[model samples]
Target: MSRLPDAPPPGAILEAAVYVSDLDAAEAFYGELLGLPRLMRVPGRHVFYRVGATILLVFDPEGTTVPTSDPAIPVPPHGARGEGHVCFAATDAEITAIRARLAAAGVEAEADFRWPNGARSLYVRDPSGNSVEFAERALWG
Candidate 1:
């Protein structure tokens, strides 16, 4: 087996791609509900949003035909269990405000949890059932 080199020195994560059932609704949810600004729109195929310093790319699942399997690749179902959640880091007050914002947008969020590292976090599911988390460190420098 051949192994590739590790990722080069760390840098900011520039973007995340999410598959959405409805591109328009996803765009509205991310842009209006989460307050992310739309960075680009690719007609009926995709929409990119600027979330803080990163870009959130939303694509239509039905419009794109992704391969299910390949010898050197692994692909799960459209929605699969055990996939990790995406965490968005914020301050304590920001987390609180975000929770309120979600509520005002009619989105239900799970209860918050405090980790052993003193980081507080909460989880919510997007329209496509992807898990999203908001976390805050207890102490700031």
Candidate 2:
């Protein structure tokens, strides 16, 4: 056995989730356009994307409300449905390539600018209307 704290650490975000009504569109935009690797997919239900060590889970709100197992799993119902935002750390090359890829896919950026800290960001919406951002932190000196 190991001796680690049972409580979660102060600043660790292990995973994030966004509820989407359509899985196909989500997969196409996140997996194909954003190039996030698809970790797994439950047909007509959910899709998981690996963003570095963080897992991005996109689930169909209508289908995901059901309990995980017959015993109910003692988990709260997440049945959330709406637009959410997620940002990924990107390199300068990735920022450029993402812009090109979005253009190729006919997806326009809602906003693009550099923050006061010299971080650059581009915001775009996935097919389900969730805002996705690709950011490069202080990449240009």
Candidate 3:
């Protein structure tokens, strides 16, 4: 089947979201451990972090599944029940530093290896059981 006609050209991802059960744990794991700058947070609802030019959104499933009273930013109610995944781009040296940081934090890499393209990836889980990945840009190149 041919691609849909008249589809407007899309830009790079501005943000990606993953639902968590606990906001506090997610905050510590992402903000503290990963060293990503905290953008904003609404306690018990969601937390946002800056990852390069994009944003990483950690949301509490229960809190987001319900409609908000405010109409200013009427983001539609949406949530996922189970695990979600997000990948962060990293360089070789950055991957090494990340490995050391994870070891210091006692977090094991669920999967760490080089892809067929020779790009390395390190995978781990947050307290919310979401699959987090870090890989070099060459992995997709």
Candidate 4:
């Protein structure tokens, strides 16, 4: 694991990916519902959204496991099956607002509780059944 003995730690996470059954559903959940600004949409393949400084890469499993036709950016084929989880950092008030938005859209939070550290977390499932969570910043501290 020491391939680069002097390599510095990454400054921050540039992106995170979660494979879904459909790209449209992913857009509805992340782009419309969660209100994340979508950066790009490669129809039938993937969608990219901005979350603060990080990009949320929503990919369709059917397309990700295959090779790209483009020769310029030959991204290696990689994909996952089933549901995955992603947590977003939020303030206490922001979490409350998010819960209300989900409720208005008839999307219920699967769980909402406080941790021993006095931080709270709200979990809900997207259209693709991925567990998406919004937690207080203090939760990590």
Candidate 5:
């Protein structure tokens, strides 16, 4: 096998995913409610959104678990049916606005927290029960 180059670790994350039970609801929540730009949507399968430079993919577990590609172009089937977590970075002002918007849309925050370092975050569940967090920039940086 060829060895990888001896170099520093990758500098950025290009994509992250959360498997969901309902693709449509996921789209409405992450796409419409959160204001993340909708990059692509494969109905009944997955929805991709632009979160900064990362592609946030919300995939329907059932649709993704089975191979659908033709024999000439094999594609592996991979998926899991369970909740996953992804934390998104947000500023203090943006967090406040997010809380207000969620409230206006009737979605309740599951929890809100202040870290020991003074960073704050709020958690909510998507339609498929995935834990979603919007945290202050300092929390992860």
Candidate 6:
């Protein structure tokens, strides 16, 4: 039914974007907590961070002129709960420390998930109520 490339190597994931209510606060949380390097910033509008081989973009929802409703599509209200979140991979040791750090910083986290692929993860929220996850893959060992 479909053609496929023969023996094609897997390509690296480049980037993902998440819209946020406050650009500055998102920048602070990710930059400080996850230790991601800030790659770029657009005044009052957007911030991009380097996460491993991927780029994570945080855009200000209020600053964007995109319409909330249209005949073809509908957008969620700003800061809607359970919409989406970003996940960052870490080492097992780092994962434990990060959870403690987030707790001390007053960030709430869901119970950790230990997957069959030897990966463990925990979910937490940022200042804007968007969820975030920290994961560690045992395969790295």
**lDDT of every model, 2 decimals:** 0.73, 0.85, 0.93, 0.93, 0.88, 0.76
Error of 1 at 139 (Å): 11
TM-score of each: 0.73, 0.84, 0.93, 0.94, 0.89, 0.72
TM-score of 4: 0.94
User: Per-residue alpha-carbon lDDT of model 6 for 66-129, expressed as tens digits?
Assistant: 5555666665444222346777878778888999998888877776778778788888888777
The most accurate candidate by TM-score is: 4
Off by over 4 Å in 5: 1-7, 70-75
Looking at model 3, residue 130 earns an lDDT score of 96
lDDT tens string, model 3, 4-70?
7787678799999999998988998999999999999998789999999999999999988889889
Task: Give one digit per residue, the lDDT tens place, for model 4 in 1-141.
Answer: 668667888998899999899888789989999999999998888999999989999999988988988899999999999999999999989999999999999999999999999999999999899999999989989
Q: What is the lDDT of residue 2 in candidate 5?
A: 100
Once fitted onto the true fold, the runs of candidate 6 whose alpha carbons sit more than 4 angstroms away are 1-10, 62-82, 116-118, 138-141
Please estimate how well model 4 matches the true structure, expressed as its whole-model Cα lDDT.
0.93
Q: Which candidate would rank higher by TM-score, 1 or 3?
A: 3
Candidate 4 residue spans exceeding 4 A from truth: 1-4
Look at candidate 4 and tell me the lDDT of residue 141. Answer: 94
lDDT for residue 108 in candidate 1, whole number 0-100: 90
Scanning candidate 3 in windows of ten residues, the lowest lDDT window is 2-11
Sorted on lDDT, highest at the top, how do the candidates line up?
A: 4, 3, 5, 2, 6, 1
lDDT of 1 by residue, 7-76 (tens): 8886878877777776777766778888888888866557888777888777776544554456575554
Cα error, residue 116 of model 5, in Å, equals 0.2
Q: Which structure is stronger by TM-score: 2 or 4?
A: 4
